[model samples]
Target chain A: MVFLSFINNLINGVSLGSVYAIIALGYTMVYGIAKMLNFAHGDIIMVGAYVCFFMVSSFGLNPVFGILSAILVCTVLGILIEQLAYKPLRQANSLAVLITAIGVSYFLQNAAQLMWTSNPRIFPAIFGNGGLQLAGGQLMVPYKTLVTIGVCVIIMVGLILFTGKTRTGKAMRACSEDKEAAQLMGINVNRTISITFAIGSALAAVAGVLLCASYPKLIPTTGSMPGIKAFTAAVFGGIGSIPGAFLGGILLGVIEIFSSAYLSTELANAIVFLVLIVVLLVKPTGLLGKRTSEKV
Target chain B: MLKVEGINVYYDKIHAIKDVSFQVKEGEIVALIGANGAGKTTTLHTVTGLIRPKSGAITYFPEREANLYDLTKMPPHKMVEMGLAHVPEGRRIFLQMTVLENLEMGAFCKGKATKEDLDRVFARFPRLQERKKQVAGTLSGGEQQMLAMGRALMSHPKLLMLDEPSMGLSPILVEQIFDIIVELHRSGTTILLVEQNAEMALQIADRAYVLESGRVVMEGVGSELAASEEIRKAYLGG
Candidate 1:
């Protein structure tokens, strides 16, 4: 019975980690290209979840359509936010941009509260409830958990290929390295940044759906914990590195779940942060982060 | 062909370029020789649209085409698309990317470059082809310079502007860079080279301009300037 429960907890941990990984991808990509820490990135996931909820519950649409709608809405929203809020401030001081990002986060939360009301809304399962039985009834994992893991794996692989092979991907890497040089190479730096935001938001939509499906609750504030945790994962993995975000998210998720399962549940959040502090103390650049020598 | 009228540029409160003017005619190698902070880079940046001039009319006349462009109004990417390439100072090659990837980015405005195009660049710098898979940051200074030029060539620009292509290079590497520049010019590419090595630049250039601080101090035939006692004492370090 202990072994079965451990296995179940491990599955739960992986599912949660995958969601964080998805959200972390957005944060890392945006930070890598634009060189700005977007604090409001987490709220994008909340907006996506809310969009999905409305599509399913109010419009009586199929769950897949709801997911698609969420992605579309979130992508447009991300691009709009970048153009309207961030573009004007591109050449401004980093501190000013950071404060604006925090302001945007607050705006998103308040807007969601005003539009959807402060009450927590129950989320319907995309896939009907219950576990997929493996090795008969002794080992059962929720279909949602399996689906989440599978989706995460696919997205991660796709992202790897996209960054490595495509022309625009090369442009993105170039832009991240040096914006002026990338422009000299004939890349439209502003357009590239917009694309980065659009893709990041689309990934956030996937994370939002998976998160709401597992937790079964949605509120304006639903994004805060996951968003902060995902940002932590991004930092722990090496803030600008994509694979680092993946590894960090999974490890964080596993640690958080196992701690809650075996140790005191109250200490799980604290322990996760403790581990991060320890890792940072040892490696200031985080795992997989390349140490950059300051150019004079 | 490229032309620049009176242009002023400033960085914050500090005036950088003061009423700078020059022109690069078709099929000519024009050298802009200046000392450190003499505004050679500022001039190139202005032409590339990396830095917009405060007041100037910079015109680009495309060969075999009736249309002319006011480059001052355009952005860097558009300037590149209009067949102007600037190989910046310090190489500025994407350090984390592979050599081949760096070259691919050169052709970004062109949409797609054929295998023949790749081979043409490879033929010019065989070392780049050998180390195509190697990370660019690991390459030596000479290799990095070659990669920077090769990558710029990938765009097939009609006018190639190089900013201090010989900076920090060994004598042999500098000679090699000059040789490649001459070869590129021989093959019908209009060259606008900004160099601190006035001796070599004037030796190879068709026409030359001497800039002091931010102003154009001298303009004439390259060899005539190279023979001048004032030019020799100030720039050529005789």
Candidate 2:
């Protein structure tokens, strides 16, 4: 019975971790190519979730269509935010850009609150009750968990292939390395950066739906916790690395779930942060980060 | 063919380049030799559309008698598309990318390079071909320099501007680099070479301009200036 419970918790931890991984992919990609912290990135999840909710509840659309609409909306929103707010400040000091990002984040949260109100809404169970049972019904995993994990895996694989094989992806990597050099090479750096934001926000849309589906509750501020955690995951896995984000998210999720299960439930959040601190103390660049030295 | 006429550039309150004018006829090697901060780099940057000069007009002639296009308003990418390539100082090859990827970036102006072009670049710099899969940053200085030049050539530029190609190279490597420059020039590419190594610059150049304190101090045939006593003392290091 104890062994069975451990497996159950493990499954739950993986599901939770996969969601964080999805969210962190957005954070890392934006940070990597754009070189901005993008506090507004987290709020994209909130915007996506709200969009999905409205489409399904008010318009009686299929959940799949609602999810697609959310992706498109968030993608456009991300590009608009970058073009309007970030592009003008590209040459400005880092501090100014950071503060602007924070401002954008708050603006998104407040806008959502104004539109949807502060009341929490329950997410409809799109997948019917009960999930696949394994080992003669000894272990029960929710269908949402399975779906979230499955989606996360597909996205992760697709992203790796996209970045590794595509021409635009190469241009993105070139831009991040040296914007001037990329420009000299005939790349439209501004266009590349805009595309990067679009991809990140689209990923965030998927994450938002899956995250709310698992929790089954939505509020204007519902994305705050997941957003922050995913950012943390990006840092833990090395800020700019794609695979690192994936690894960090899964690790953080598992650690958080296991801590909550076997240790003090009240200290789960504290434990997650504590692990981050320790890891950072040991490896200043994070696990997969390359040490870069400036040349004269 | 390219022409710069009375171009003045300022970095905020400081005038970095003043009334600089020069011209490069087709199939010629023109060297702009100067001390550091004397505006050789600034002049090159202006020509490549990386910097907009406050005064004077810069023009490009793709064919000897073709329409001359004003280049002052073009962006760097557009300048590259118009068949100009600048290999900036410091061997600014993408450090994290593989050598092949770096070369691929050079072809970005054309949208893509044919396999024959890639093979030609590889044939010119076999060292790069051998280490094509290796990360560019890990390569030695000479290898990195080769990658930078090979990348610039991938665009099949009609005119190539090289800024201080010998800046940090050793004596032996410097010889090899100059040989490559001569080879490239011989292959029908117009060259605008900028260098602080005035001796080497004059040896390979057909015509040269001497820039001092943001102004053109001397202009003559490369060998005439090289033999001049005053030029020898000021730049050729006796």
Candidate 3:
């Protein structure tokens, strides 16, 4: 019975980790290309969740359409934010850009509160309460858990291939290394950055939907804690690396789940943060980050 | 053919280029030799549209005729499209990418690099071909310089501008790089060479200009400047 419970917790941890992985992918990619920490990225998740919620519940659309619309809306919002908020400040210092990003984050959170109100809405279970029974009903894996894990895996593989093979992907990698050189090569730096924001925000939509589905709590602040945790996850794995974000997210989720289960429910977050601090102290660059040295 | 009619440029408050005027005619090797901080790189940058000039005009005649375009108004990438390739200072090839990838990026303006283009560059630098799969950062300094030149050649540029191509290389490697520059010039590419090594630059250049404190102090035929007593004292070492 103990073993079965452990297996259940492991699955739960992975499911939560999968959502964090998606969110971290958004953070890492934006940070890598734009060289800015976009604090407003979390609020994008809130907006996406609201869009998906209204589409399915109020508009009575199919769940697939709701998800698609959410992605589209978030993608457009991401591009707009980058152009209006980030582009003008491209030549500004890092501190200024960081402050602007924080301001944008607060604007999004307050806008969401005004639109959706503070009361938490129970998100509709689009996947329904279903599961696979194994070991003669001794263990069951929920469909939501299975789907979340599967989607995360697919997105990871797709991202790897896209970045590895495509022209635009190579251009993005080049821009990340040296924007001025990339521009000199006729790579259109601004367009590449806009495309990055679009991709990151689209992933944010998927993360938002999955997060609400698993937790079933739809609120303006629903994305905040998860967002911070995923950002931590990105740092844990190596902020600019895609694979790092995945590893960090999974480890963070597992740690959080295990700590809450075995230690204390109230201290799960604190434990997770403590583990992060220890890891950073040892590695400095996170698990998979490259140690970059300046060339003379 | 290119013409710069007294262009002035500033980097913030510092005047980097003061009424700098020089021209590269068809099939000519033009060298701009100057000491460090004398604005040789800035002159090349202004011509390539990487930096906007405070005043004056830069005109490019693709056909060497009445058709001329104002380079100051054009974007840097558009300058590449007009068959102008700049091998920037410090050999700024993408270090994380492989040699092949760096060359491919050089041909970015051309949509895709043809097999012929690859062969052409490979023929020029067989060393790059051998190490095409190697990450650029792992290559030796000399190899990186060769790769930078090979990358610029991939654009099939009409006019190739090289900035400090010999920086940080051994004397033997510098000779090899200069030899490659002369060879590239022989194959119908107008060249704009910027160097602090005045002796070697003057030897290969058809016409050369000397810059001091952002001003063109002297201009004459390569051999005459090389033979001049003042030139020998100021640039060629007394």
Candidate 4:
């Protein structure tokens, strides 16, 4: 039983951890380029989940099809968010933009609540009847977990390839390092930033569809808890490091699941925060982050 | 192939460049020499579209346009697309990206850097090829400067504007950089260079302009400026 449960927790952790990773990519990429923390980022994910739900119920589409729809639509939403919410106030101080981001986040969350109501609408399942039983006290690993992990892996790999191998990816990296310099080099910084938001929100949309499929619930505020958790994972791994965000998310997810299972479920979220505080205390730059001393 | 006429630039009433004017031929390395805060950089920035002058005419080629471009009104990104490459005061490479990534960014204006272009850039800066996979921030200052130059070259610009490329470098690296600049000019790249090191700049430039207090104090051939009393007195540690 202990072995079985441990395996179950680990499997569950990977799936949940992936959600954090995908969501954190949105935060990390935007921060990398804009030097901004899009506080409204989580709500973007919630909006994605809601859109997926709408696609399925209103259009009688498969959750997988809904996932793609969510991704395409969220990409537009992400770009719009940048063009409208962030771009207009870019020249303003980070504090001003920060406040605006929070305003946007809250606005989206509350707006979704107003439109969708506080109730958690059921999401149609895509994994089919689950559970592959293993030896000894009969541990069962759900098929949904496998699918979730697969999707996260695929997206993560895709992201890494895009950033490492593509021209636009290189442009994004350039903008992140030095926006003024990137601009001077002929890269369209504004367009690159918009593209970044689009890609990031798309990742969040994928995460949303997965979450809805796995949990079978919907709410405008659903992305709230996971948003905070993913933020924690990002900080724990190293905020602007894309690969670091993924790694951090997985570790945090595993830590969270085991703590909940072996200890108290109520202590789960607290443990994640505690780890973040501890990591911050030990390494202010997070696990993979490097210390940057300001050069005049 | 470029000319500036009576250009005036300001930053909220703090006049930066006052009636500054200069010119460069189709294939020439023109040096702009000045002391700190002499508005040399401001003039360069204005030309590069980072700052626009309040009133001036910057005519390129045969000087046929009706009114000179309000460079100040143009964005930095547009400047590059127009075939101008500016290497800023600091070597601003993407620190998190690799050497390869930095070079790729430089070629962003051209869309895709052909294999021949990559090879040419690599040949010009072999050190970059050796450290293509290395992260930019880890590179030494001299290497970073080389990377900056290499990155600029990747844009395949008709005009290259460099600001204080020798600000901080060992004497050997400084000499090497000057040698490279001379070679770059010989290879037919038009250069607009600003330097505090008047002696080195004069030695490398075909012609030179001496700026003081936001105005052009003197202009002459490089060798002639190198021999002038004013150039010897203020710069060259005379």
Candidate 5:
């Protein structure tokens, strides 16, 4: 019985981790190229979830259409936010950018509240509420969990290939390393950054949909906790590394799940954060961060 | 052909370049020799559109184009598209990228690098070709300089501006780099060479300008300026 419960918790942890992984990828990529902590990224998730929720619930559209529209809306919103809010402050101090991001986050949250209200709406299931029975009904895997894990895997692979093979991807990498040098090489640095935001936001939409599907609760603040967790995952893995975010998210999710399942559910968040603090103390650069050395 | 007619640049309240002017004709190497703070790099930066001048008309006449372009109105990438390449100071090659990837970035304006472009760069620097897969940060100082030049050449630039190419290299390596510069000059590329090493720069230059405290104090033929007592006393350790 204990073994079966462990297996069940592990699957749940992985499913949750997959969602965090997808969100963390967005955080890491934006952080890598733009060199700013976009606190509003979390609010983008809220907006995306709301978009998906309205499409499916109000319009009675197919789940696929809802998901696609969510991604499209989020992508456009991401670019718009970057151009209006971030672009003007490109030359400003880092603290100014952070504050602006926070301001944007609040604006998005309040805007959602005005539109959708703070009453939590139960999210419709895109994947059917069903499960696969294994070990003679001793263990069961939900379709939602399986699909979430599969989608996350696919997204990760696709992202890796896109960045490794494409010209725009290489240019993005170049900008991340040195924007001035990249500009001199004829790479449009601004365009690359905008594209980064677009991609990050699109991924945020997918994560939002999945998160809402799994949790079955949608609200203005639905995305804040997950957004913060994913950001933590990014920092845990290595803030600017793609693979680092993935690893960090998975580990964080597993830790959170195990703490909740075995220990007190209320202490799960605190435990997760405590683990992060200890990890950071042991390795200041996080698990996979590169140690930068200045050349004289 | 390129012309800079009396450009003034300021870094905040400090005047960095004071009404500086110089010209590089087709198929010639023009050397700008100066001390650390004399603004040789700033002149190159201004020409490449990295820095905007407060007042001056910097113009470029392409080989086939009849009209002269106002370089001050263009961005640095646009300047590169117009066949000007600046091998910046300190060999700012992308450290995390491989040698081949850095060269590929140089050809970004061209969409994609043809096999010929790769061949040409590889022929010039065999070391880069051999170590093409290695990350750039792992390369030695001299190899990095060669990679920087090779990267610039990938753009097929009509005018190549090299800033302090011999910086942080051994004496023998400096000679080798100068030899490559002379070879490139011989192959019909206009060159603007900036260096603190006045002795080596003048040897391969067609015309030379001496800058002191952001002002061009002298301009003459390469060998003539090399022999001048003032230049030798100021730049060359006499």
Candidate 6:
């Protein structure tokens, strides 16, 4: 029974890992353009989940409509964060923005708790529970988990294509390389930065809705740890590298899920943090990061 | 035509440009010449809106008061929109973007670049067309210089101010670059050029301002300045 449970946990870990990867992409993309870790990003996700919960419970909206609402709201919130928090101090020290992000994160979390209450509100069912038969034995894989994994993959692919294929994508790449130069080219750099924030927040919203479906609870502070975890994924993948962020998030999720069964949950979180410390020491730029030498 | 007047600029506590003034008549090339610390760069920067002046007024003619802009105080992007484009020293191209992307970026002020405009730029610097898709940082020194000028041109400015366009090029490329400047001037683009190359600067500049320690010590027609004993011994090395 124990061996079967371990095998079952392994499958569950992969599905959960997909959700983390999807969320981490938001952190990675925003970080790539804005060049700062958005400490409030996870809260954006939490806000997303709450939006869905409110829509379904109060307005009796379809789950899909609620999901779309969550995305739209998160996108607006993300752009607002940039305009209000990031834009003014763009040329200031990175520390200023990092601190602002932390303040925003806390502010959003507290505001959320105040608005939605500190108590965990139940998330209405998006998928009923059932396990599919695997390897001749039934694995307790919820229908929600499969939907989450599928959604994450689709979003990831869409992001990759958008960033690589379009002219606007080319402009974004230009801005990331050098903001001053991009402006000289006549590109409305501010608009591009805002768009980047919008996309990143929308991705976080998707992850939030999926997470709510899996966990079935919503709280304002819910995005906090996941925020840190997604940031970790971004760093692990190579903070500035997009594909790296996605890979890092999925890897982190799997590690956390399996370790929870192998070791105590507290130990698991601690171990994950320890791994980050090690990765930082070993490769300061993370797994796929390119080295940028200082120019004279 | 562009005119500058009575502009005093300070960096921290040090005066960088003191009551310096000059002009570039239509289709003319004017050079701002000085030793390393002569505030030549600052003069260009002031005109380009990189740094604000401490005191004094700068007004253009005919529309002097009407087209009034404290050029030193405007934002960098806004300055470009006002028909003043600057090509900074050391060829500051977007290191991560391709050459084509860098060139395309120049036209951001213009609503979308036409192929003809790109062709004109490419005609001016054929090497840029060859490496349009290559990342800018990897370009050779001469290629980067061309790219820097090319980018400034993309904005279609009436007055193009360039700081040290030939700073680190081979003698051959420097001459080629000078030739291009003369060609550009002949084609009707007004230029405010700053340089340490005294000899070459005078050869093409219609007018010149010689600066020393942040103040203009000499100003005249390029031919007259080239013949001065002070310019001959100290700057022209004649």
Interface RMSD of 4: 1.9
Q: Per-residue lDDT for A103 in model 3?
A: 92
Candidate 2 docks with a DockQ of 0.69
Predicted candidate 6 versus true structure: per-residue lDDT over A151-193, tens digit per residue: 8788878887887656677678777877765655555678889
Docking class of 5: medium
Q: How far is B87's C-alpha from truth in model 5 (Å)?
A: 0.9
RMSD of 1: 1.3
Better of 2 and 4 by DockQ: 2
Q: At residue A204, what lDDT does model 5 achieve?
A: 96
DockQ computed for model 5 against the true two-chain complex using alpha carbons = 0.66
Q: What is the C-alpha lDDT profile of model 3 across A1-296, one tens digit per residue?
A: 99999999999999999999999999999999999998888888888888999999898989899899999999999999999999999999999999999999988988888877989888888878989998899999989899999999988888888887778888888999988778778888899999999999999999999988899888888888898999999999999899999999999999999999999999999999999999999999999998875343
User: What is the per-residue lDDT of model 1 for residues B118-236, given as tens digits with 9 covering 90 to 100?
Assistant: 99999999999999999988899999999999999998889999999999998999999999999999999999999999999999999999999999999999999999999999987
Query: What TM-score would you give candidate 3 relative to the actual structure?
Result: 0.98
Residues forming the 10-long window of minimal summed lDDT in candidate 3 chain A:
A287-296
Model 3 B-chain TM: 0.98
DockQ of structure 1: 0.64
Give the C-alpha miss distance for residue B88 in model 6, angstroms.
1.7
The i-RMS of candidate 2 is 1.6
lDDT of each: 0.92, 0.90, 0.91, 0.85, 0.91, 0.82
Give the winner by lDDT. Answer: 1
lDDT of 6 by residue, B153-205 (tens): 88887777888988978899999999998888878778889999989899999
Please give the lDDT score at residue B194 for candidate 2: 98
Summarize candidate 2's per-residue lDDT along B1-238 as a digit string, tens digits.
8999999999988998999999998899999998988999999989887788999999999885567789998877777778899999887899988998999999987776678889999999999989999989889888888999999999988999999999889999999999999999999999999999999999999999999999999999999999999899999788
Cα TM-score per model: 0.98, 0.97, 0.98, 0.93, 0.98, 0.89
Each model's Cα RMSD? 1.3, 1.5, 1.3, 2.5, 1.2, 3.2
